[model samples]
Target chain A: MAEETKGFSKEEEEWIKAQRAREAERQKRLSRRGGDDKNAVNINSLMDIMVIMLVFLLKSYGDDPLKVVDEDLKVPRSTAQLEPVDATVVTVTRRAILVDDDEAVPIREGRVDPSQKGSGGQSSMRIIPLLDRLNDAVEQRRAEAQLLGEDFTPEATIIADQMTPHRLVLEVLYTATEAQLNQFRFAIIRSTTESVGGIAEATPEI
Target chain B: MARRSREEIGQPDDPDLAPFMNLVIILIPMLLLSVVFLEVAVINVTMPLGGSTTKDTDEPPDERLDLSIALAPNGFYITAAGYQRPPIEGCPTQGPTICLEDDSVDVAERFEEARRLLAAGQDADGESVMEEGLQAYNFRELYNMLSGFKEDFPDESTVRLAADPDIPFALTVRVMDVSRYRLTESSYDTNEAFWSAEFATETAEDGEEQFANLFGDPAFAVVQ
Candidate 1:
């Protein structure tokens, strides 16, 4: 019985032990390879989120004819339902007045600088710089229309801050009129309120 | 010989999404830069025709409403072609005509009281605040008066809106808003219409519901 239990010789026992060690090493290598595979980024879910966000952002971009991106400009809220038309934009920020994003005149203390006004100085309704820019814009539009064999419809859009004085607005409008841009549109944020027959509840009196 | 079993062939690799991921990542920031969150609309306005430009013609002159609304520092001065009435008590007149007064709220008196309180270094305490419920201009009253004019001259659509130099542009916009449309208690679900003849409901392009048109055409008039 003892001889049978110890039937394998030293060399045989050594071979068996070596075979077990080899199997363990092979298992370790397999596990290492599996861990490496796990490290590879599974970005499928991430791609899904990114694609959705991209679609949403693209839809919102460039949908409007005019974009009021200036931080200083706070357009008044109105119940007017008319959509904005494609026209020359005259922006009146707190610090300056811009025509087609070009600063035409500077404003000080919510009023146009006296030096920038035409003839009558501060009391004048005409703004020389703005009038010049508007005239050029009108002439360019006219030339473009003529080239396209279409009639020129002179129009402009006024995008003024809510706190802008009415005098400044009138001056801009008057300047545009002098430049032969008679049609005007005042840009405002569309208000969603039930008080349509009266002033909005959030409107400040003064 | 039998074809190789399915297990003998390795699974097909996933389509490379690296380029797509890069594209999406780049496009997101670019689009975000140009995205506009504010819903902007426009109020159409025109410069009032100057009196000096009246042309000589053989055609009989049409009777005009000549509706003008002047937003002065004190109050609104309204003038029309045929409408005339005595001015409110203690209200001032424009030349020979009795202009309308802002009778709804005494904004000037409220400001005076506020100034006094501030000078005395006192808090409002239980007293109503100066700006609360006290509008500088009586916009509701103005709307009512304009509605009356619309009733009288349904054909007249033009109104000359003038404003004081110091008036905020927001106030002018508010006036324009009130002048443009008259809101009724009508909804899409309601089959019945209140004052349907005057307050017709129309859906805007963006699916927003709107009320009937009032003096839809407003012209900017130079302050006299």
Candidate 2:
């Protein structure tokens, strides 16, 4: 019968030790090569440039969220012969009114009484609420200016639908004028003329 | 071989960049992915009025001129001879057999015709003609039209651009910019002999005096 033992000879042990030593030397050589490549490639500088580019792109993206609303209520056309100078714009449509193309305030069906339906079942336009909101926006702007100790000439530009009743358009205009925004601009379509200043101003009916 | 220096102990020649490269590769695409293109208003404006009033220009002796651009659904009408009430006579209708409740003449055609008329009025030839097709009024056409009007009516250049309420706002702004350009050239013209003398000689007191003296007042302005 052969005897079984968990022991190795001295020669076998020395051979195993030599194999381990060889592996360790190979590993050291590989590490040294990797270290030499680190300075040549300059990965940090490359990353710095990429990070700067990313930041630049982010800063330049001043996206306005207002244009994403119901495109069905797009602004109407006009050939008014005036240049639109620096002014804040408000757009009114059949379904809703947009403030600075950012917020859409829905036009609620006007009610005559708090609890009862309007007479003839026709709702009145909630113009007062719209006016109030506009006033609030103006006040907010004013407050911001006050905080900065700067005076700003506030001008409100109204872009209304052509199908809108004259009364409604007039009321909005009246509200804006009352709000002390004299420098108003009404958008219009392009004309044949290159210069806008030459076109005669539209006279007020009043 | 040189002995290992103690000062060089624990000094790594290369800094770790795997995390940073990972961040950059992800971030570069992320930032690029985040960019969005938008259309911003370069020129703002409003429209002018009295565009359809031809009676104001009826008196040739008054030297008043009227130009009207009538826009219908499929076509446009340009009547520059003198502003007369839109001739209600020849409204185009849908074909003989099939007439729809809302069917009417080509409003786009009328817009084109109006464009042609304006072009003709501005042209030295005074012949209104247009290229076939629904040409969206762009910046160039507006520039040509307004600049020509400015050159022709150096004294009083009033152009009435009447468009259907349904036209796009962006289109309107491009048109408005054309009108705005008219005043820019006037600065150079003020240095001309005729304008300088006219400015020097104007001292009218009454409305009639003002009317007589300001007969040549440049009236090109935008009204909506």
| Backbone clashes under 3 angstroms, per model | 0, 54
Model 1: CAPRI class: acceptable
Candidate 2 regions exceeding 4 Å error are A1-41, A62-96, A100-102, A107-130, A156-179, A184-206, B1-27, B34-39, B46-105, B108-164, B174-224
- Please report how far candidate 2 places residue A124 from its true position, in Å: 9.0
Provide the lDDT at A38 for model 2.
39
Model 2 per-residue lDDT tens digits across residues B76-119: 34334354333222333432111111234343453345334433
lDDT of 2 by residue, A79-99 (tens): 333445445567766445656
On DockQ, the leading prediction is 1
lDDT of 1 by residue, B1-224 (tens): 23433333654445778788888888898888777566789999888545222224453333556677777546667777645433444455532132323345554455445434433445332113333222445555566667777777776777877776666676688778767876553122221221121455778779997776778888886643
Q: Between which residue pairs do clashes occur in model 1?
A: none
In model 2 chain A, the worst 10-residue window by lDDT is A109-118
The stretch of ten residues in a row with the least summed lDDT in candidate 2 chain B is: B211-220
The DockQ of predicted model 2 stands at 0.11
- Return the top candidate by TM-score: 1
